[model samples]
Target: MATNLLKLNNIKTELMVVASPSQSKEVGDVLLNVDGCTIRPSQEVRNLGVILDCNLSLQAHISSTTKSAFFHLTNICRLRPSLSDPVAETLIHAFITSHLDYCNGVLYGLPNKALDRLQRVQNSATRILTNTKRWQHITPTLKHLHWLPVKSRITYKILLLTYKSLHTLAPQYLSDLIQQHSQPRSLRSSDKNQLVTPRSRLRTFGDRAFCVAAPTLWNSLPLHIRQAPTLETQAQMEHDPPGSLTLQLQGMRLSTSNKSVEGYTYNSFTLQLEGLNVSQESTYPVFLFILFSYLFIIVANLGLAVLVFVDKSLHQPMYLLFCNLSANDILGNSIMLPRLLIDMLRLPSERLISYYECVVQAFTSHMFGTTSHTVLMIMAFDRYVAICNPLRYAVIMTNRMLITLTVSAWGVPLVLVGILLGLTIRLNRCRTLMKSPYCDNAALFNLSCESVFINNIYGLTFTVVLFTASIGSMVLTYTKITVVCLTSKNKSLNSKALKTCSTHLVVYLIMLFSGMAIITLHRFPQYSDSRKLASVLYHIIPSSLNPIIYGLQSKEIQNFLSKLFKSNKVLASK
Candidate 1:
């Protein structure tokens, strides 16, 4: 091994002991040899052109790197009079910017004086590019060049690394630095699955560590920006020409000549909610009718949820699942109706929403709706067991079983919708106007200027997984239940089985076909009043019908509500 090491090319070795303040005077050098080469001892060593000192202040490294970068930049500056803008930028990026960005995250949490040296190198480069005086402010120059400040560049580097580590197929060592924060309560749904940074005690270690700087920078970004899948797109989303992120960071917008930023368009994103086909004269009556209907849906679902919550006798797994369905109904309607109402009653100009906001609304609406489908499938499975496997039903539907099924019903849909939303945000939405009244994945995806094969393929994948897994499960479960009922010796048992399963089938058909119809319309678009009407019905029918389906079909709920209402009436008369 020693003879083999001697044959290696361009390799040099050094030793530097990192001793604490108390051991500063006690340590002595020890000699070592590798391939008959004596190890040289020094206070600092340069690896990958970054300096590391024994004290670990990082000050010496910063000073050395800045000096070297500035020396190259000054030589490039001498040719600036002869070079064009693009050529000059290429030279600066190759020589100067590359050095500053390399291992910048290591300098994180260092004192301001250490950063000042690097900042001075950057400022000099900007001055050479713009031919501006040294005394002039550097903010505008940085913005024009689309360069983040030295501190911001460090943060950007760390955050980009963290994003890749968490979302992409990263190596195990880098991936282990951050963990998803799993808390019972989150500030917002968007914040629920944030990556947590581990704490450290050493100031330099903590400051430059990936864990400390990454989470702070990641959390500081808006949810939409953080949701961006790539560092390139994240930077693109953050760079709005008129009021950019850099301006927001400074707390004041800088005044500069109106120059266009390369590779960015100043166009604003706007989406209009689709309106009802009714004429202006009849719009008010339709609006009023829709308003009353929305209120009734909310009141019915809320009342059912409360009944399930308060009535101890009705606290069975089936009723608890009904409560879950009703809650989802309320959520789905809440996402769609308020915006629909606002668009119907207001002028056309008032109906516009930004691209990111549209993505969020579309994501949430689908999440709740998909969750409802999953819960319905679970209910079907529940009844199938009660009828087909009567003896083991108790064991199969235990409290632990019920909790696991319920959590999966909600959890699976949330993750699926989040994946779809993340992919949708990456698309460049060039078209501002949408014909649909409400935003959805299909509608917004169609508005993108680029080819949408990935989006199309994923949409089909979602539909297949949802229908084949969920609906197929329901069909198989019900078919088995039918076979068992016909084979049963007891006629009364068969009658009881039919009654229980029929209600669930009816509810399932209503939700399944409504969802299928919406997807059909979304896939094949034609300008018709029916498209808008279908969207309205898709949002309305499931929510409004949930209470009626469960309440009328449920004998126990009817008995409890009848006695409770009568008792309330008697008290009111007094």
Candidate 2:
């Protein structure tokens, strides 16, 4: 073979010492220098790590005549450990090649920084697993188990290694140095132009005329030249913020969005855009109090249901409605809290609900809500007649009439809610934006771009009529019951009536005034958050307090629960 020689600046070397024995003498000179780097040998892989076997030893030769470098690798993994000399030599060659373009990359870190990590990972026949927390469903990844079922451990190690390598390498590159790597890295248009412009490639190194005798890189990149202030500042201004990723076209970005941002910034007009910035990591403290309210209601209601169902002696008409209300309280929460739990797990962007789904959800929620209100009214009337007009109570509220009123109580809300659902759907929901976690009628109407005159009118009219009719019935029934009780000749009936009606009166008024205030606020365009929160007190506080009210009012319910708990304790002791 023909012979040739190269000279590299500062570090002279005869690479023929590392060449193959059979190879003819040849030399290709080149300089290889880095502006910045933090390269090192990777950590030792634990357990039975990679076992590589090979016949050929790694041999690198610089061809001066043809201007190329050749590497013959043999058992190279065992010798060099990481990124074998052959690979490093090839990388050096590519870094030096002038007829290359790497113009679509945007990075700011050192080259070959990740190459130092390859050997730390080793191939093993057996796999590994990890452990995690109580709340976590899948096992966690904090510590690895040395052995695992191959099928269960389906993640591929090689792909993981490559990704980690990229991560380690990416940060060291700036947007300008467009060096063509062994496997191509993308460069931006500016970087591509910079690469094509050969004069920008090198700066003086070591204050000497450079010479190299290897086919690999021989670049003279000075420390200050690596970060030219004028060039870097311009790069920062163009790409760092208000500049387009690609070349700016006549002074505009690519999309139709009025959002002008190269990065996430700006606080101006933000509350109008996002409404709230809730962190996923934090739980609202108010919800914990709400949880307590739910827990108390559940424990109380379950106790009451058990008493009515198991203790046959306690099963009567008045007690039956109490049980029904308790059960309804349970059902109401079943519909609400799970939704909040799910919403907590997701990011805000994923919390978006389709318009149709929102309308249906709100419809169902209010249907149950209004049913609870109407049920309280019926309970009021039942206690009213029983206490004041005891002799005529059975005849007046016959089973047929009770059934009819109950049916109407359930039916009216269902029908009104259906109408609300149909009316809300008439508006095109393409532009709809929900302001609350779950849908609310007021929020829906507010989101409509089209005139919401009919929607608001119907909602206001229905809310008024329903609240007045229910509240009026309670007032008239209780007042009549009161007059009758005070004037009754029977001393026993008067005393019983006063005690019974007093509790019902307080509970009814608590529910009524709160419900009316809530409906009243909806008529206003905006209400304070505390005012809105006041309505939840009507629903949540009453449901929680009902058991306490009834258990205190009725001696029978208290005794039943006390006896049942004692029996369970006896059974447990045995």
Candidate 3:
């Protein structure tokens, strides 16, 4: 009788049971006519919702589960036209992926062909969501959705399970399975904190077993990633380190070999030129416009720089700062505008640029742009000394001090952008269509396949600190100058002070507003069309207008130009 029996194990839960044809004997015959128990040979048996088969490979269960999932997915796809993306994603997850994920820990060391079968299901699922054609690229789509690949996902789950086991006591069996190594090594991190996976002789069982697979996955994790507070955080930890963007090409196991461009093997990254949106009809006009603007930027900024350098009488803290601004304008424009003009005129088929070149352009643009911020802060400090304490101005901002400030103006931006570029060059850029006239750092960053949180954090920190210091110093200096002007009894002195400060104020305002507009547009993708326009204006307009604004308004520049033009007229008459 089955009533008082020990371990009556073979139970059936579904119809259409499968067994070997040679062993299709009746239950009563096999049981030797046991009194109270009977078996249903036609019914299927399940353990933990996973059907067990005569073969121990788990092949039949995986096959049946996959088929059931696809059958349900095919029905769901028919409702695609009426389904929103979120709803469709929900349905796919509920019906298809849930089946794939269920008891997937048992699939740790499955054959490649078996894993490939499941991978095809995931690829199809992603394709369905994006409505991508069969032949179109899928890697970028997966990256955009932040979905880890099949192999990585398996590793992620295993490592996450290990993390939980280490941190929590609820899973006593899992915790006991992991044994920390007792022996220590000489290496820095080899303090015996690592879990030792017990080796097994049976390869099939060993590879699929939890003890072996879990420690292998756990040991691969960096200490920081392994120390994650929760399973969700552990799941979110990236497969590679912060500056490991380029390394992920090989690390991801997505491809066997890297693609070659111009005889050099590089991670494929194409930068799109977004700001050159002018039509064929308007090409020459735009070309001429940019050409003339560059010419004026060059002539104006260089002319001011030359004037400040050549004229001994005009050499002072103020004009030296102005010279630095002119020089920075030259540097910033030279980096971006030439490439932009070339790109704008290039044939549509020949528009592709080297990935390294794009990175260089982004670095230089940010370097000079940020240096301009630093120089302006120095200029503000100079103004504060001149206006607030004219008697001590020379002593406080001596020649040596000005030299140090100039060096800092150039040096500080280099350091900040060096860190940024160092991080940037390591990223795996998947998309190449640059969305601006030139390779903007922001657009370049957006194209990366790996986690750019470190890049983003550093950028945010630099911007906040630079802008805060620049704006705060300018406001404080201007406030003090205004108070001094109000308290002064001499109308002539106040008038002169206002005139001296007005040109600098006008230049600062123009640069400040243009910079703010460009940053705002950059931060918001919804302003895409406007961002392109703003980028062009930010790069060209400011460089073009800075010299014009200073040349037209500054008495020193105006006087120098007048004298030079008179000398030219005298020479022409001769």
- Total residue pair clashes for candidate 1: 3
Tens digits of per-residue lDDT, candidate 1, 1-574, equal 6545544232566777765544556777755675566775678888877788776777788877877887898799889999998999899999999999998878878776567567667777887888864324466767767777777677667767877887765668888877777767655664634667667777655546777767766666676676777777876765667434352222233232222111111123655555566789988887897788899999999999998889998888788887789888888778778878888878765677766778777987888778978998888888888888879989899999899989999999999998887777777653455667778887777655557899889978997989898779887998898889877888987987777788888888888888778767755657456777777887788778878988998888899989989999999999
For all candidates in order, the CA lDDT equals 0.75, 0.47, 0.71
TM for candidate 2 is 0.49
Which 10 successive residues of model 2 have the least lDDT summed?
A: 119-128
Give the TM-scores of the predictions, in the order they appear. 0.54, 0.49, 0.57
Winning model by TM-score: 3
Pitting candidate 1 against candidate 3, the one with the higher TM-score is: 3
Stretches of candidate 3 off by over 4 Å are 1-266, 269-275
Per-residue accuracy of model 2 over 1-574 as CA lDDT, tens digit each: 0134533332322111222223213522323333332222211211122211111121111111112211212222233346544464354335322111111011011122111111001110001111121112111111122211111111112112212332353334322222323325554533311112233222211111111100011112222222334544423432323222231211332221211111111111111111223444445665566677777878988887887778778766677666657876777665554554456456555555545556655775677567777777788878876876668887987868667767876787788878876786665421333455456566565543446788878887887887788779887887887688667788887777767777777666766676767667756637644444664565577777777787888768778778878999999999
Q: What tens-digit string does per-residue lDDT give for candidate 3 at 1-574? A: 3466754444432334333434444322332222444544333357788775543356777788768877887888798889999999999889888888887777777665456556656666777777854424566666656555555556656766777788873389888888776654467656535788787866665666788888876676566665666766654554334323211211233321222111110245444455577789998898888888888889988987888888776788988887888888888888888877887788654567667788888888888778878888888888878887988987998889999999999999999899888887777654455556777677777665457999899989988988898888888889999999899887886886787788788778877888899888776878777877776777677677777776776777778779989999999999
